[model samples]
Target: MMIPIRKEQRQENMHLKKTPMTKDMKKGMIEDMKKLKRYSTVIKSYSYMKAFRLLATSLLVALSMGFTSCGEDELDRMPSTSLDEGTLFDKTDKLFSEYIKDYSNIKCRYGLQGESSVLLSGLKDNHLWFSEYDAVSKQLKSEWIDIEKTDTIQQLYKGYGEYETLYVKYVAPLYYKEISTGNIVTFNIGGRFQTIFTSNHKAKRTQLQYDNSKNGIAHNWYKESVFIADCCYSHEGDTIYIAKSRPSFDENGNLAGVTLVSYEEGIELSGRYINRRSFKEGKSVWSTYIAPPFDVPSDAKRNYTLLGNTTNIWEYKCEVTFYDGTKRDFTFKINIDNGKIVTDEIKVTGISINENTVNLKQGETFQLTATVQPDNATNNKVIWSSSNETVASISQEGLVTANSAGETNITVTTEDGNFSTTAIVTVTSNEDEDKATLARLEGTWDMLKCYGWEYNDQNIKENWEENVVGEYIFFEDEDGNGGYNDGYKTYYFASSVEGNKLILRNSEWLDGKTSIIITKLTETELHLKAIDSVSEENYEMKRR
Candidate 1:
């Protein structure tokens, strides 16, 4: 509708209508531009600061170089990054002191896994944290350093495994000795020593070779401390040989590095050493078991002898004889409180007789042997006795003597633990004679009178007599069963005949069985005398 207008005016009007500018929007744009300018300034300042830090680092390096190149003596005078030998030894000593509390209580058990040998060697080196001198001192500057942060020290500390816990429970230093050799200083520490086995099982070569993984055998042993020294040191009954490599020093006579050497011999306790020594507080009690410190052959024999007074400190001597005709002796001392010693002596556990049941004729004798449960029992002596001596008798030496044809029990009892065993002994005569004797006495007998007599200077003197004119009735059957009735009541019994003897077995009898010698027997009359009777009673009966 408008006439032809200028192109520039038309374009300007379209822009103003499409984007009308507000006061708030213009202020926001101005703020954003100021923030961008500040950011650019910050970037430039950061680049300048980086360049300045680089220059400062270069200057410090130059100064350090200038100081180091001053002179040979001056370079040598500089502080060393590595710890000195003395300082290292001091630290190791301190570490050992932390674990070991009582030197007399330390013990060790070895010979299973191969790693045990490595651990023993490390322990023998006084638990030296480092193998060679280095900048370790710079890192160990803190008073309480975390062992986990130090790799080398952590390895050495954890390598002890379960023994590390044991150290905290039962270990302590006894004493130490110092030996000087030019630039080398060796420290010898003394402590107690124990073997892998106690006196009960003993240390044997075969047992020591047992593989824990293959056998699944668990062994309980006391913990021991590893000795540290360059020479052999003997204390009490233990001798430890420790050796180490001398420390290397620089031209300025400063320690540079050190090496730990393996011991000359194995870590086994050898010869003689204390196994168990313990004291009870306020109880004056001391007990111990001693054995050879080293492993011995299986065929070896050991004998122990307890010496000294029981009321005071005592000593035990162990003598061993090997299969190869070699012999060794070891001695141990035991201390007690208030001059009182309490020892645990071996006791008999059980006893067995050679024969469980024995058969013998009258007047026959047999020697029986009793074997104790353990041959090494402190008291294996036994006492032998017979239940019914009237039928069979036993001597103190387990000799059985059949006095009459009957059955009796032969018992042997141990003196130590009162352990006992019994054997049944049955005495018999010829079959034909026994049958005849049993058949001849199978009827009821009249009342009887019994009398006991003793010889008074070659004159027969009746000491006691009992009248039983009609009060008693004795009867027997063809089957050898018999009993006696006292008019009011009747008692029954089982009987057997052997030679000129008659045996009556009844639970009512004191000894279970009664033995009577058939002095006279006939169809009309029967005379009986009790065997081994205190009263020597003779009974006379008449068949009714």
Candidate 2:
């Protein structure tokens, strides 16, 4: 069936819009024509301009027509059937409504599936159990059905008839069975079958989300069981107790249960039975009761059981119960396993400085270290301060610098508690006026190295040759003729050792004397400390 094109194309042409159609425009028009064909009957009749517009729009559409007439099958043709616009829209609206309803139902059913599946299983183990007693014979028979046991329940479906082989292939292989008998019997008492017994030594519950190191069993549920199993008719009136831990102790002081294991393995599974019940119903009908759903503890500690060497990498597992009642086991791989008990100091008792007293020249600095006793002191944080900032200044890192000639105390106070230590600092500066020290400074000294100093750290890697050349100093009484000489210039200065400082009155650059601290003065080497706009710079010079 062929559906004519709409008159809108002709109306567009009547507007005399002379825009030429490109290949892309023609391709789009063909697709639009196909969409229109779904409801083409609503278009009354074909227009002369409409046909001309299609011929002008796309050669592809014309090619499709040729294919249709040549070998295309009826399935390729647009349907001759057509519905009114209102009816078509109504049908589409109904389809959207049905789709939305189905989607919503599926989501709601999926949410209920977890709960519904457990409740309908009846036994809580995803299997069936039954017990019946013969009144006349005075005998009781019990049966346990699980999905994993194949010998017992598996045989019932094995060739019971022609359907046996079919059941074995499709159904029987999917289930398991286990049978136990006696007047006093226990089922999965030691939690060897973790899925059946829902408890552990860590806690009755496990966590679903992992956040900390303490209580998390990665990707496993928490399971434990200690229950009363009595088959004797004499104890029919006795209460049955079920516990989350093992009931017996092994030689190693660990819980004795299904498997020969203990807490020494880092994980503890020992627990005692605590649940109780009456055996009155056992006489009439042999009852096979499944373990009750273990109630996850709301306030249970997740870090109850910790196993492994913490010095190296170790795996940790714990169960966490989420706020929404869902429990999950989470595992963590960590270097420091906080789950293990470690005794750390809770308070600080005493503090002491490395140096009790130190003598320093003006502008000289010393690095002081404070030791907090017990090593494990809760807070070793200390605050450094100077008794007199004008005499000596102390940095947060315990670096004390002498600013002038005076005495001051450098103190370190513990931030954790009230504990402190003080060091005496004596600073002296007489402008290096001593005649003997001045005589010792009377020589030509060559700069060998330079140093950059920060709070308590110093770097000796700076290149001094790049900054200055012929860095030699000559200290002669009043005659500056014995100074250094370079290709560019010759410089001289009058020098003296005033107290512990080196006073240099340069006749070339400075109008006043520059006093530098002689940090280290030996017969062969001399070390000087100087301050710049940005930081303190130190220099080492060798006497020539």
Candidate 3:
């Protein structure tokens, strides 16, 4: 810390006194040494702190040397070496991904990509793809195989028509045909396995390749070859088949499925390891959303992103599944200068609503939402829907609405690799006023007591009246009374003054009649209770 604290050396040099001329020379030399430190380059040999101490010491020495004939500019004691540590190796895709994640200094986005695939005549279109390794150096100019000279996947793209490397690399999808039927078509033309039906043409817009040129790699389209095998579409897209591309073309032209091929967007060439804010970019995983792929809403658009330099570095795109069960990709990157999504590689799996049963009345609407999580979801694109297409269907936003009166389950799907959740939505046209009413008072009801006490008692014999006078308790509206109690076969009457009270007349009095009071009413349920009755009872009912 303090120059190793050389106490013995300092003590030994302290006892030596210099002559008057020597002292003056040492002082002059120390003064001269202070002038050389003005240049920052001269401190190359010293650590940041050491440099300061050396400058101070040299200044003291220069002051002494100025008075003497000793060489005042003797800086030979300082070591000589190049100051450059050389640009960082870009070692690993770590820094590059971090730099690009927030790559604000560059004129263009670090690794922006092309829109979805377009119609490629196998002659008039250019290709989009990428290859990368964990380690690479920029020094290799004409070649791209790295220092080992070993052939990497980047070699396949070496002459994909003079496409030069860019500051940003991305893995863009290659689409063709008028529409993407989710059916990857492979045919033999010119003796090579060529893919023909994997279309991504939207609005007949005549798509342009990343290089803005024609593609010439049909030499090895989908054909039978030693380089490919074991091809099958995802369970989501059964008819579609894709294969690993190679620099060489297959001799036999056969569409039969495909061999599992590895594809990386140009933006991920630095490494699969992404920044913390975005996807980790290791292995890719995929899943499906609610309903089968075709059953989703026709207007339902798919949204996702690929983890790039930064979390903000994304490729924002919309996808729509057709009635015929085809998926198409689109991007607004053309309209917005810097769109939000760098990559659109999200895979949805299982999704489910929190509610298992939701009840609604006629003309009344309710919302059902679900959460979707993907296993390897670089993109959070999810699909939600219902099993019975006719009864109820779900929206892309995971909201379910009541279409008709019936029982239906809302299912949600993230992707093949995600979790799915479902809820049973039951819609009925019943009003709430009845549910609350009948719930508290269930079972057949009958009159229990009559109004205006007509009991025969010793204390008040005059109160007894049967043949001449009668008292009745009954349920009634503002008009009058209710019908006969089928259980008791008794007639009832409501007092014109207060007949609206729901009550029952009891046989002990004159006739069995009950008074009822409605306290609450709503769309689904109604609550009612008998007041001052044989037994305090409440009734709640739901619509049938």
RMSD of each: 30.9, 29.8, 27.9
For candidate 3, the per-residue lDDT at 426 reads 73
lDDT of 1 by residue, 190-213 (tens): 111111211122221111111222
Cα lDDT computed for each candidate against the true fold = 0.41, 0.39, 0.31
Better of 2 and 3 by lDDT: 2
- Candidates 1 and 3 compared: the better one by lDDT is 1
Question: How would you encode candidate 2's per-residue C-alpha lDDT over 1-544 as one tens digit per residue?
Answer: 1232124323422434234435563354344334322221111111221221111112212222211100011221122222232222123223223222221111000000011111001121223222222223423322223333211112111122422211111010001111121111111100101112111111111111112221111111112112222111111112233222323333322233322121111222222111121222321111112111354454633432344532323344456565666666644433222322223435778898999998998889999999887586545678999999999999999999999988999999987676998999999874543665766666777877666643424543343323444576667663323454442666765655556776556556222323467898788888877654334567678888
Instruction: Give the per-residue lDDT of model 3 (tens digit) for 208-229.
Output: 2232122222222222211122
Which candidate order results from sorting by TM-score in descending order? 2, 3, 1
True lDDT of residue 146, candidate 3: 11
TM-score, candidate 3, is: 0.24
Instruction: Give the top-scoring candidate (lDDT).
Output: 1
Those runs of model 2 whose alpha carbons end farther than 4 Å from true positions after fitting are 1-344, 433-544
- Against the hidden true structure, what lDDT does model 1 obtain? 0.41
